[model samples]
Target chain A: MLKILVIGATSLIAQETIRHFAADGAEFFLVGLSADKLKMIQDDLLVRGAKQVSTYELDLTRLDKHQELVDTAMETLGVIDAVLVAHGTLTDQKAAEQNVDITLRELNINFLSAVSLLTILANIFEEQKRGVIAVISSVAGDRGRGSNYVYGTAMGAKSIFLQGLRNRLAKSNVTVLTVKPGFVDTPMTAHLKKNPLYSDPRRVGKAIYDAMKSERDILYVPFFWMFIMMIIRNIPERIFKKLSL
Target chain B: MKRYESWTRQPKVNHQTIVPLHWRDELPDLSQFDKLVLPFGLGRSYGDSCLNEHGILLDVTGLNQFIAFDEETGILRCEGGVSIEEILKMIVPRGWFVPVTAGTKYVSVGGAIANDVHGKNHHTAGTFGCHIPQFELWRSDRGRVICSPTENKELYEATIGGLGLTGVILWADIQLKRIPTPFIDMECIKFRTIDEFFDLSEDSHERYHYTVSWVDCLAQEPQLGRGLFTRGNFYDPPLGAKKEPRALPMIPMPIDLPSYAVNPLTVKLFNELYYNKQLRKKIGGVIHYNPFFYPLDAINDWYKVYGKAGFLQYQFVIPYKETREPIKEIFRRIAKSGQGSPLVVFKTFGDIKSPGMLSFPRPGVTLALDFAFRGEKTLKLLDELDRIVFENGGALYPAKDARMSGASFRASYPRWEEFADYMDPKFSSSFWRRVTSS
Candidate 1:
């Protein structure tokens, strides 16, 4: 019996991940931005066989509310076994490139806000000495391509921070896993044309759920993205930057 | 705001807009508008039954919610927008299954009821509407009302196969079938002709809970309707272990293929290989219901295989007495046309009365053929088949119908006026307009 907390519970991928847990009667605490969507998911999770489900509507970027959201989750779902951090938006590449304001906001939502919550959970898990903290990092973080360099930069920073967190928490038995998904078909990416490489959010969510069960530190969803990113990462800066990816 | 097509992707029309609605939220008041409004679910109805041409389509896929479930009795309740896939994923592990399901699990409950869809197991269980005990409907003329077999009976009968013209279905209470395991004990047998198929079905229907066959429409005369007949029954695993619901990986077809990709020659060749690929004449295996029921769902965007032009699926059921001669005639006409569908299905239907007034299934053997849109040539051929089906006193299923004429419609469903009496003035669809007009 796992007691889990899902932040950004209404996101397509996160909702799918919660379904796996709900099927097995896991207790849940969900936090998302939309009140209507949160209620819908709470009801859905209950029907899917979750033993208990509690939801809170909060804007993730509201720094002052972070502590309140976490405290409520911890109190509602006592002895949390795992925390799935699956909130983040694909930044508008053009908007970020032209405006610093847009770039800063994107960084706050994708990296800073998540780091704020993780910092709070890391300490809680550290004191408890048992818990898994899984965060979603994009494959765009592996190596920045010109097409989406700003989004890549924010994701890259988040991945680097999680790497340090995982290393530091190793001795305390608090496992931190970084998940890198590539081209998931979701409302976030609906504007872009889909290709053969695009994977369903449910499939990606399934992979992420499976990865957390094991003791893996870094997981590339769909698995092949690891090799694809490895090749992209190894490319020379001169040739890579010259051509559009 | 943009133009859209039916599931078939043919005759793209400019729609007012597609608003993917969440049923929990207050529905927008469309009474102010002059355009006819219709509820659109997963858009899986291969024909115009799901389309509101040049008008507003209230996209209802987002209303999916599981409202209630009684574990002991296997009775379930959910929003009409909930898909069969979502229900199976939740209940199958609990040893409960949908009483009836379509070829694809993506169809919404509203669509299933609207079409009165039937699956291979229809020989025993009947249409999807049969298991539905009650449903709530929202109409412009009549705000909201609950209908069922025993209560509000006329509306219930009309709304089931009313093709969404009656109103928007809010939620439904369904009685689910209990099963020992999620595994299906399946067997596939080869048959050379429609007569052999009839003989085989007569025997299989009593032993197995579900039965369906696939005919190679391209095969001529001596081998006219050669096919693989498949039958299955829910089986309990040997030990105490229950099978976990397995979600198959869906690899997408990235783009619309070239028209030549699925032309006559290729279909014939593929059918030849497919028939022979079943090396053993008869084979038995224990399998999950996912692959057993939904073979096409294994590939995401499989409809794209029909290419940009899209394809039409013509499924009509003729009574048992008229099965053989008409089936052979239809097969010969298809083979001679040099147009073929790689996947052509023939199945036995039991003597079950449809819960919907316009329901398609009756006591019969039915054949469904998919034909690529070849413009006039295709229309002419379907008209010929339509005439045959009409003459035999059989009806065309509105779910898979796009081009059924008013005369054929009248011949098939004499009770259309009975269904029309309860029709919501604010609701209408492209199919309804086409079938009942000049």
Candidate 2:
């Protein structure tokens, strides 16, 4: 059986991803911040005919707990066949700028924490030479405007980091997949807009699962996003900065 | 368990199934079940019509088998998943073609009926559902059922454009129209104003079987509705010249380009060039059916060009009497928005009855346009257009729509409840969940 570790397991996307792989009889060790949420997800997975299900309550921002979380997961499950890093916080840019502490917290939660966890997982996969890493980034990183540039900067950095990881792990037979979703209708952006090409979490989960199975290097969730963002990304900076977009 | 959040992208409210069972070819033996949703072909539908989110989504592509063909009568029977493109490849060379075709031929027969798709020939031949004589539907409550206009009339009507809420379609028998030749005698006409364009469309409708116009959305004021109208009908091939058969080929876009590629300026420039390039007021040419019907098919994975943020396709139809007013208002609003994206199309639909109770068409004009998601502004503009459609007594095509309100839906499709009554509760989807719950 293919063993999988899903970080931020309670997320809409993570839950769906877990359920997708679980239905395929893949073993899973789910990690999330809420014990209640993890239990709910675990129960749902078991009912769906998952091979095995385990859960760990994790505060991803706590870098000190990163190694322990991975250790616990590996001990509970067998060797990890895949690692899905689906947890990230979307801090309001204005709020982050207002407070220095908030800025650091946002940076750590969105980028540094993910880097710390993925680093350990990547190293383990590199040694095993038989695993896949899937990261969920955002299209907001393509080009940051005044509205959400801080969050976009964090995502941009994460994307670059994942790219380098993919290149470094190439020879080791470990595949790294980057997923850039535009606007997703999750609790993260529920307040923003309703169905604004906001991909359903289930769709994102399936796309990621399919990408993992196909070993695709990168996938834009809701395929159309790839083109929509292409049109946006091609605009010249001089012209782009002027628009209220 | 909801596997991939992405799959839940386009579900109905309250009926959204968190987990979707992904099956490739073989359909699960549904003999034991009481209700199931059949989602075959492409998921281009606007509503939860085909999706039974909570139950099973029987993929019928694997059952695709071309059964019979009448060389003389031009009648054919094929499995549900057999797309129009597949049919064109087999029949076009023999001078036979489908009675009607939608903008995209990638849709399966099952989808074609589920939506009661109408094409450029709708004015002349009616919708695709009208040409279909018989079909086999597998229902959970009732086993294998054969239906047609004369046989199981209610079930047949319910199944046609019924959004597959009735059952899984196994195969269908349809009447195909025979043409003198595979080539079309086409003409292109340019109109500087919407009024002039409608006049040309009215004139062409009397003379030609196929009529459509591509509007330049970027045009302002005096040129707001400037467009190129193309009309055609099959014609006999010249004597002694062998007909050059054109095959429909699949095109796929391999890579995702960066966002920010298509903006107002770029699209404006492109539309200007495209509109201007067709300098000839009228020209006769023999073009492939694929390009004529499914232009987007020429470029595979064309959606990827939209970048990481997917675009939304908004298509609505107004009754013939109120067509000009609503269309003019919609165009005026679009031009004023100044956020240009290519692909604004307009066409006139002929007398056609909706197969399903809530099916979205009437004898009138239809307009389809694509817009990038721009948060509140886009929604506001769409809301304005929705009001226009509602006021004009026109409904939005649910297949190509993603963001329509319940109130608007109620206004657009007055017979929604009649169709809703037949919805198998177990058969729920994200699209249905959103609409119902909200």
Candidate 3:
């Protein structure tokens, strides 16, 4: 059975991805912010067929607590077969743009905090020589748009970091995967208007599970997002800057 | 603006705001919101019951997480937003099954309870609410009320089939049926006349746990009520018998086929082919539960076959009066109109009483048909059928109703006034507003 460690275990996408693994009788060490939410997910995973589940509560934004979480997971699982960094906040781009504190806090949670955990997990997986490190990035990272540049900036940084991590971990056989999901109808996007472009979280979750199992370096969930992002990325900067996206 | 439509995709309404409840503990402070809010699940209700027009919709799907399950007793406690599909996936491997399941598995437990949904096995098992021993209802006024048969009995009865107006069902405890395997032993018998259909149904009711029929509504007088009668029970295999579950790959129908493509001529041909597809007069086999219960579900978004204008599901149950004349007259009108319903389900609900005050099922014969929305033409036909049903002391299922008169609703559910007393003042729905106000 695979021993997996999940950060942001309460996040909808993470919970769905873990459900797929749990059905295979995987053992899990989950870390999230809310103890109540964590406990609920722990029970859910157990019922889904997880052999064992243990949870720790700590806000991911607290970069200082990163090491303790990893140490606790290592102690619980002995050797982690996979680690999923699946937690992040969707900040209000308008508020983020107006306030430096808000912008910095958003960056801290979405970029710095994830980087902190991934950096530590990368070392442990390197020493172990066989494991997978998967992180949930966003398609928004592919290009900065006027509508959501603040959130895009943080995800863009995380995406670049994962690219380098994947390169270094490739030699050690510690597969690093970067999941770029398009508009998913999760709680984070509850306020946003949903359209045909918005994919269900379960679909995105299944894609993440499949990508992690296959050890793919990069994945654009729904596959169509790959082309969508490609078109957005190729647009001329002058033309892109003039149009509202 | 994002407009939410029911499964039929008709009468789309825009909720003022959609608040997603992700965790059970993280329920929003409903008191803060002045406007009436209704908890919405998978939006499988065929019509307006699931819609709130301009009111808030508390999207409970995110709160879909299992709380507890007793393997020995086959009792499961899970968040109300959990789908039957999810429940089956979790419990089927453990030799358990939902006591009652509708034609589709996409419906949330909350929706099932609110609608008091019944199924093919309803003759034996009753409504889905019958299996729900207890659940937590979160109201704007009363924070959390645990409703059951003994405690808060009125609220419990009112909440079931209360049309999501009573309150939000947070989590529910369901008593699951213990099955030998995930397969069902099914038999299909063809009947040429309404009398034969009734005879077959009456004969099978005592033997089969699940019973239903598919009628070709477009057939002429001789074969007017001609259809196939199917009956089944949980597959009980020989000792040490090995079972391999199989499910048909879901074929997604196009988002919208042209309205003209699904007219009477095409529907008639399709119905004819479907009826004759089974060459043998009788066939029996062990089949997986998925296809057995949800034949239409095998085709994802099967409603799209009705076309871009969308369709309306008209399901009504008329009390048995020792004759099948009411049903025949109704079928005669539909056949005469040449409306050509591509799908029609006919079943007889048994004496198993439901716990809900406003539950649709009773000791009656129920017929459900889908009509493509074609302006006033479809409405006129249904209105005529409603007269027959209402005169016969039948009730239109609120879950499947898009347009039933206020008088028809009140006449059908005599307990609606009593049920109104238990409804949360801050909870309302489009269907409720339309039927009650009129």
Candidate 4:
């Protein structure tokens, strides 16, 4: 059976990820920050008939413990077939702009943590020469905008890092999936205004799962975001810098 | 290099972002690239399905040329890059038209086939892919080869709605459907509810040669899905005015609409007036084929209405059996969400199996809605809609979907593995990169 580890299992996308893999009879190790959240997910996976469900209380920002967590999860679940790095913090741009600590935390959780986990998982997957790593990035990474450039910068870094990782891992048969979602409905975005371009976590999860299975390089969850971002990214610098996009 | 005197849009793809790559038009002797994106006439495709990103995007319009035509047989052979506008310019004067035309004639033969684009006639004639007898595809791995229904069938199916992932289409021999004339006899019927719209749409199939409906998204409850149902057929002379002269006059949106111009208040007002104006019990009329087929082509850069932040067009198809319910639900959700951006449309699809295993279509009803770039809440609502679509066993259209999850994609297109197996190893794109890399 496939062994999968869904980091940030408490997130909406991660919840869908757990359901998808668990439903397929794959063994899953759902890791997150809150024990209660992880247990709830474990119960859902069990009810969905997962091969085996395990929960790990994880704080991805504790970069030092990332490898140990992977090692422990591997020890508990046997060889890892896929690793989904879905954990991220949607740091408030206004708050971060005012507080250095908030900005640092956003970077650490959104970019640095994924980088650390990917580095470790890349090595492990390289050793195995066969495993998939799915990273949930946002279309916000396509370009920096006044609205959410801080978060965009973090995702952009993650996207670029994953691109490099993908290039390096090409020969190793290790698939690195970068999911650039346009907009997804999640608790993180509940307070925001309704978006016509928004996508659901399940849709994001499906796109990620499909990308992993197909070994796609980068996927615009929902797909239209590719054009939307392409247009946004290509806006001449003279014009783009002036807009509030 | 061949150049026509027509006042053509220098770079025809819909994405104003594309800077045409100049190359020698001497064909049969092209560059050796790992992969090339064929950007046909109007890059109308909502996604990069037509873009190669960092790879070479072969601007096929340069190869635009009419190779052969059999007026009697209605069989036409043309260069892959020939645009429908180019065809209409020549053939419409000679009394002929495309068997099927998407919302715009700006698309090239290659883009049309690559997208397997359907139009009002989809319920009758099927997609452009279905009419193609065969096409020449240049694959990085396999080299140049001819593919058709009976020859290299897999490659043929893969190329259509394959999102150009299969290879570059060189030229094609397509069987065109002949019409009595270049003009159309039209009729407009307005409906109040989703149920009435579907009923009329289904009933119109037996009585009309062409049919399409424009739904007003801002309308709520009783007025939901209210739209002008237009059905028409080709007619001669006095029956219909000679098709509108191709006035090469460019009508660009004078200025970018104010950022907040398309919010709920304005859209509601616009929808109310638009609905009332089309509230006529019956409006029988005769119209030119150009206005009937490519209405939006008259207004260039129309997307600028959403201001610099281009809008997103979400088109989804639900099976015929579950059409009314989901559409009602989808409209209700949109109305309740207060993310009002209009130009919502609903059309009944006829019987035609999707060309590609993962192509988006079934015996069903399809709805398309346009939304301006709003922040997070818009995404959340779309996510909720995605769940509704999933639960109904409907699939989102890949050509227009940009926010679908990998899991949802897998579930929607179960035969994705089959399409994946044919993906050119060297064929990598930013879109592909985004999906594959994490």
Candidate 5:
């Protein structure tokens, strides 16, 4: 049975991905912000056929506890075959633009906290010589936009960090996958107006699971997001900077 | 905000507020919203029952999460928003299946319970609510109430087929049936008359676990009720056989066809071809469960075939009398109206009683047909059919009805007033309002 550690265990996408592995009797060590939600996910995973599931409650923004989180997971699961870092907040661009505290908090949760965990997991996986490290980034990371530059910047930074990690861990056989999902109909986007563009979380979850199992380095969930992002990236900077996106 | 449509895509109504909830523990404070709120599932109720018009829709699709499942007991506890498709994906590989399923796998468990959905095997398993041992109903006033047959019995029975007027079902514990494999041993036979169909139905009930028929609504005289009868049992694949994949992606219907794409002439031709597709007198084989139970689910948004104007499914059940004469009269009226529906499902509901107080199925003959909305013409035809059904002591399925009159509803479901007593004051739907006060 494969042992997996999921950092955002209660996240809709993370829970969905974990379910795919659960049917195979994979063991899980879950880390999340809410104890109640994590407990629910643990029970969910157990019923779905997980061999074992353990949860740890923590405010992930406290970078000081990153190492302890990994240590606990290593102790509980013994050998982690995969780690999915999927917890993050949807930054309110309006609030972020007006308040430095809001902007900083978004950065702390979306970028720095993830980097803290990845730094520890990367070293452990490099030393162990095998494992999958999957992170959920956003298509907004492809290019910063006026609508959400704060969130875009954080996701861009996380994507770049994962890219470097993938380069460093390649020779060690540690697969680092950066999943860039487009507009997903998750709780994070629940307040936004939904359209045909928003993909279902289940679809995104299945894509993550498939990409992790196949050991792919980068994935544009729904695949169409790849072309959509490419178009945005190629837009001339002069024209891109003028039009509100 | 997204404008939501029910499966039938008819009677489009704008819900003032749409709240898509993700976590059960984080249920919003109901008192904050002034308007009545109806929990919306997969929105597959075919009509206005799933719509709230100008009120609030607490979209529950985001609450799709499983709580527990026991391999030995075949009992699954999951959030109400979990779809039958998701359940099948999880349990089929584990050698278990839903105790009862509708014609479509897209429906959420809560919607299924609220409507008390029935399936091909309803003769044996009864309605979906029959197998629901218990569920958690979160009322705006009462907070969370655990409803079961033995506890809160009145509310439990009322919530089933209560048309989303009771409260939002938080989660449910369903009893699943064990299956050796996700395949069915199916037998198909052809029938030429209503009496032959009735005879075949009577015989199949004793021999088959699942049974249904396709009737040619356009047929006349000698071939008045010509159609195909199909029956099946869960196939126990021989040991060492290759196991089928857990789930197959449904082929999507990306766009709606033109409004005139499904006219009577086209329907007649389609029905003719479908009836003659099986050349042999009788055919037997092993078929996958997906097509056996949910043929339309094979194509995502199959209803789009009826085009942008949308369609309405008219399904009703009349008690089986000593004669098969009433069905012929109903079929003749349909044929004469020239509003032929290509997909007409004819089946017999057995003696199995549903726990739902307003459940549509009984020991009777049930007929379901789809008609593309043609404004007044279509409504007039259906109104005529309603009078005939009411006269025959039949009732319309509220889940599939968009315009059933209040008198007809009251006449059919005599317990409406009793059921109304259990409904949450803050919970209501367009269907409820239309049927209760029209």
Candidate 6:
């Protein structure tokens, strides 16, 4: 049985991911910002085969309370087998570019706060010497594009940080995984036009769970994002800059 | 935008699709543009009830938002575009379920009320409108108004099963029922004949809250009407723990099947295997509410089985007081035509009164069948069945009727003239135009 800790438990992707675990009778300590919503999910998870579900309400951007949330979950689970950081927002690049205040706030919520939580969990996992740390990044992090560079820059920094964590935690046997889901159809992306490449949130949830179980260091959901991102990355800066991609 | 098709995939037509982003957002006034308009939800209607040919469609699905809900009392106020599936996803874990649901949960709340859909439990619960205490009706003429059984009583009765001609339902308030869990204790039995079915159904109805059957429409005179009857009740046990239902991954239809895939021989073979699948005379077990109620939902886009030509679902109810001769006659005609439908459902409707003036269910035995579209041949066979059904004082469900003679409809539903007075002059559908025109 997996003793998992899921942040942003109310998110559609996170909810679907929790469903996969609950069906297997896993114990979960769920953290979110809303008490009522969290409790509803707790009841839902209980029905989904979760051995036990404990919910804590704490806004992820409130870095001051990160320690308290982690301490309570650790006490409840004793030793967490997996720490899934599924919190982040799809930033509006145009807004971020125009407003420094918005840019910093996006960085605080999407990158810095995640880095803060990861640093804390990595220390606890370092002592345990065996735990998986997974976080949701995007294929956009593979390169800076004019369409979404402001948000892409933040995710890119975190992806690089995960690389460093994987290198540092390897000796301690604590695996750091970076999950780059291509284009999952969730509430977050419901507004965007979809095509054949769009993935269902449930399937994306299963893919992430499978990657963690297999202890993969880097996972590109649907497997096509890797090739697509690779091509985008290898493009010459001259042509890329000239194009409106 | 691509042209949309209903579940049957028949009457394929083009229309401008409009999705409102907010409740107060103005819906395009059809009178201003001189365009016929119909509100589209999930497009689960088996026919043209949700479609407007060569006009405009106000896709109100984007207006989906629950206005308010009292969880303890299970009274919910939500936007009409919200699907029954979405409501179930929210309330089921809280130990509550829809009071009445059709064979599928994909229908929108507005759609359910508009169709006045009935289910296996219609014997006790009546149709969907019986559970919908009130809703907000937004007509171009009346604007947004609160319509209920008590308030705007005429509109309330007309809008239920009014086929959306009454107006677009902006939001609905539904009354849900409490249950112990989402699991149902189900039992299945095999009956050899219609007489035997009546006896079995009478006995089962006394014991189970839900009962329906699948009959072999292809059977000949000697073996005719053999079927498997299924009854279920919400499984009750100690409530120390809640068990959530798990669904298998939905398998979307990869491609359209060949049009010739569903001939009489194939239907007969499938029915035989299905009828004999349970070797035991009686089998009972506990299963999820998903499979027990919405079996086809597990298979996404199961409609593709009908191929490119799509299909037509013929459903009718002849009063129990009428002789069984009409049913026997209708089946005889269908079998003789060599167009026996692969999916045939049979059920008994109890004395529960429907609130809708145009509601289809009555005290009767109902049979619903689906036939692949063979154009004029299929229409002729359906017309023959319609005559038999109407002559026996039965009516066809307007929600499922793609093509029924106006004379047959007028004969079946004598309240049509009274109901027609309330129809919104600015509202119409392909179905209304098809059935009401001379």
- Residue B74, candidate 5: alpha-carbon lDDT: 80
lDDT of 5 by residue, A1-245 (tens): 89999988888989889899998899999999999999888887887788999999999999999989899999998889999999899999999999999999999999999998998889899999999999999999999999999999999999999999999999999999999999987888877888788888888899999999999999998899999999999999999999989
Candidate 3 docks at the CAPRI level of medium
TM-score for each model: 0.78, 0.59, 0.94, 0.57, 0.95, 0.72
Number of the top candidate by DockQ? Answer: 3
Give me the displacement of residue B160 in model 2, in angstroms.
Answer: 1.3
Q: Please give, for residues B14-126, the per-residue lDDT of candidate 1 as tens digits.
A: 67766555545556665765889899888777788878788888776656777788888787888888899989988888889999998889889998898888998987899
Which residue ranges in model 3 land beyond 4 Å of their true spot? A241-245, B1-3, B245-260
Candidate 4 structure quality by residue, lDDT tens digits, B339-425? 856566578888877566556666788887778768687778889888988889888876676567777777887877787787655
For candidate 2, what is the DockQ-based docking class? Answer: incorrect
Which digits, one per residue and each the tens of the lDDT, describe model 5 over residues B223-255? 888888889898865688666533333211112
Q: Report the lDDT tens digits of candidate 3 across residue range B236-355.
A: 877776765443332111112333557888878777777786788987777788778877776677777676888889999997757678889998999999994667789999988989
Q: Which of candidates 2 and 6 reaches a greater TM-score?
A: 6
lDDT, candidates in the order shown? 0.83, 0.73, 0.88, 0.72, 0.87, 0.81
Alpha-carbon RMSD, candidate 5: 3.1
lDDT of each residue in B273-300, candidate 2, tens digit only = 7777657776556666656767766656
Better of 2 and 3 by DockQ: 3
| RMSD in order of candidates | 6.1, 15.9, 2.8, 24.5, 3.1, 6.8
TM-score of chain A of each: 0.98, 0.96, 0.99, 0.97, 0.99, 0.97
All candidates in order of DockQ, best leading: 3, 5, 1, 6, 2, 4
What fraction of the reference structure's interface contacts does model 2 contain? 0.00
- Residue B267 CA displacement from its true place in model 1, Å: 4.9
Going through the candidates in order, their DockQ values are 0.25, 0.01, 0.54, 0.01, 0.53, 0.07
Pairwise DockQ winner, candidates 1 and 6: 1
Cα lDDT tens digits, model 2, A127-153, are 999888998888888788788878888
Candidate 6 at B226: error in angstroms? 3.7
